[model samples]
Target: MSIAICIAAACLGAVLLLPACALARSATAAPASGIPATGVIGIEEGQLNADYWIRQQSKPDATILDPRAIAAQNKRLHELDASVHDIEHLPARLTRAQVREWIEAMSQPREETLYDERGEEIPAATLAALGDNLALDTIPAEQATRYGMVVRRADLRTFPTRLRVFNAKGDSDIDRFQESALFPGTPVAIVHASKDGKYWFVVSPLYAAWVEKDRIAEGAKAAIFDYTRKTPYLVVTGASARTVHTPEQPGVSDVQLEMGVRVPLLADWPSDKPVNGQHHYASHVIELPYRDDQGRLQFSPALLPRAADTSADYLPLTQANLVRQGFKFFGERYGWGHSYNTRDCSGFVSEIYRSFGVQLPRNTRDQAVSPAYNRIDLAEGLSHEERLKIVKTLEVGDLIYIPGHVMMVVGHEDGWPYVIHDTTGITFRDRTGELARVHLNGVSVTPLVPLLFNREQPTVDRITSIQRIRP
Candidate 1:
């Protein structure tokens, strides 16, 4: 049975259990648009793909995350990677003028307009204290840069504090300055620190933000960068995985590495060589970053058991494998800027493609309008039917861009396009024919046509573009 038909039939069964008056009212109710009432959409039987993903490893011909697919478009990918604000591609030395610029950009005190929990204005003294927390004058002058690596998944914050602030009370989410997150093993340049002597302002390949001092380890520039490009690395392809427990090396033991994180595999270690008394033969020897007693950067060896899910290399870049990889995060929570140990809309899609060695911008707007991809502009004065026509041809892994959001096309059912996206909310028609909004707050499946923008405007009427990463 079609998904819509199955859902309609299920609703019909619910009607059979309702009171007579409710049933009578339902008898004349306009049929639902066949969109699933809940955020979880069902996958059809034929959508299964364990075989393809499994075979791709043993049979190289079947792999999808092939860099060669876009090798000819290398220039485009380079441009996209360059667009990020990360320090990985920046110069090793900064002039005094540049240091001042970074300090000015990152260390300014906030304006005195603050609010209390009840949305009431806060006293001036409280605002001053908040400003005092930013020790801007402590910024250093010109210096040679030191390299660092994220030892753990760390929240990127606007300011150094763990405290959540808002323009008004009762608004706890977004945290105003929760920049993005830096996953484990992400390379960064240690540029500055907060005035309070707590947070480190480091720039990764994708973003620059204040991360907790304990979460990053500074190291030799050559050692840090070389470790990332070293051969025979294990790529963490799952949502997240950890090293096997090591009591001796608590600093690096069982550290969590998120999807697309790659760490070098210690090649050909003797069986007697062990990390924390565990024999190296049974596990992969991977180098992990950590901070020393004085809070400087250092590296250590840890063992990732053979059982932990990882790939010898990145998964190949192919549409079929995209669906399989994306589904691995099916129910992850929607975190803005990769907050709360979850990924938001753009972050979700980017991580999925990252497993296949693809790079994406940090936000929905950039990913949608990025010149690096094969984009179909919906703003070309096209009519409603014309836009729908373009949507019909959407392939698997195609990114559908509706303002403020992005969704990956898995496939279609009965001409209704289905999308897997990390989202906060979804809109669908209720049994009574009125639009209903459900807070998804996680990765979800939904049809593209019935989704409403702001629960009022049809997404179809306002779609800005449809982005396809593959040429």
Candidate 2:
């Protein structure tokens, strides 16, 4: 029987057992009031399980795209998307004008009023100092491009400073300076540096932003790319994993590896040898990036426990695997620009698909408009009913874009489509038709139809596009 029908039958039995007076009192009880204690609405208890959604798929195990197909799609993305860069193929030298353009583009003044952590408005002089810190005048007429690899997970900032700014007073969850993050061993081109010599303006495959100098190590382009291209790597399949804590090799010890991060495996290592004070038998030996005292790039062996959630290769792109991968991050805190050792909306979905060897743009705006994927662009003139019709047709793993946020379709229940997303909060119509707001502030699952983009519109009416990661 359907879930709705089962719920109706249970309610009927409960009503029949209640006393007449109790029933009369219950009838007048307050309308299905505030958001549930769990901060999730429209989700049945059973819907939380990956198996529940997997069972709903007609062909859960069917491959969405084979290895060759995924490779072709990635190549097409690198070619078509302006936001994605092919750093390995960049020119050896950069002109002053070229470097200036990159710096000026990202250093634009903010139109909105920004407040510091103390709730004080940022002074005009302070903003000007930040602009000066860009050191655009320092760019040489012709300079050799420097290459490097991220030695650790590092924050990508909008400006060279580490000052945190927010849109509103007392609201500090979203840091405007935080652009994105880079994983360990990710290759990059160091284009410029802050006047303070503290941060580098780097161009990574997915983003270009200011990263701390200590988190990256200067290296030869060939050596950096060679390390990234090494095969027989281990793919992180869990929400996150960490290397064994080691005082002997602190550079590679206790390092956090997020989902989809691939590290080259030391496949030929001797079985009897210990790695950083740990036995090789209990762990997988992997080569990790390290920064020397002189800030030069180096490699060291580290131990990733065999019990950690990892795979020898990318997981097969299948419907069941999509549900399983997404659920691995369920309830993780929403971290803007991958802050808090977690991820935001786009990062959440990108990492899940990355584990399957599929590549996507790093931000929602880029992913939604990219021509690399099959997309359904929703016109502003489309009626609400028309948009709902399109949403109902979305298959598992399809991405739904609504302005700044994106959600992955999990499954359908009682004719309503459910989605999983990392978000700050959700708004929906309560029993009395009054809009109720819930501060979810984390990865959550909710039905799509009842959600509100704001008090003025439903989420369906605000969808800008839907992207399908398929041929």
TM-score per candidate: 0.82, 0.92
Tell me, by lDDT, which candidate is best: 2
Show where candidate 1 strays beyond 4 Å.
1-65, 70-75, 80-82, 85-89, 96-132, 167-171
lDDT of each residue in 288-368, candidate 1, tens digit only = 777788776787888988877789988877656677778788778767767787777788888888787777877777787
Please identify model 2 stretches exceeding 4 Å from their true place.
Answer: 1-31, 34-39
lDDT of each: 0.67, 0.82
Q: Over the stretch 146-227, how does candidate 2's per-residue lDDT look in tens digits?
A: 9999988999999998899987788677788888899998999999999999999998999998999999999999899999
- Candidate 2 lands at a TM-score of 0.92
Residue pairs in candidate 2 whose N, alpha carbon or C atoms collide under 3 angstroms: none
User: Clashes in candidate 2: how many?
Assistant: 0
Clashing pairs in 1: 64-316, 64-317, 65-315, 65-316, 65-317, 66-316, 66-317, 218-297
Q: Cα RMSDs of all predictions?
A: 7.2, 7.9
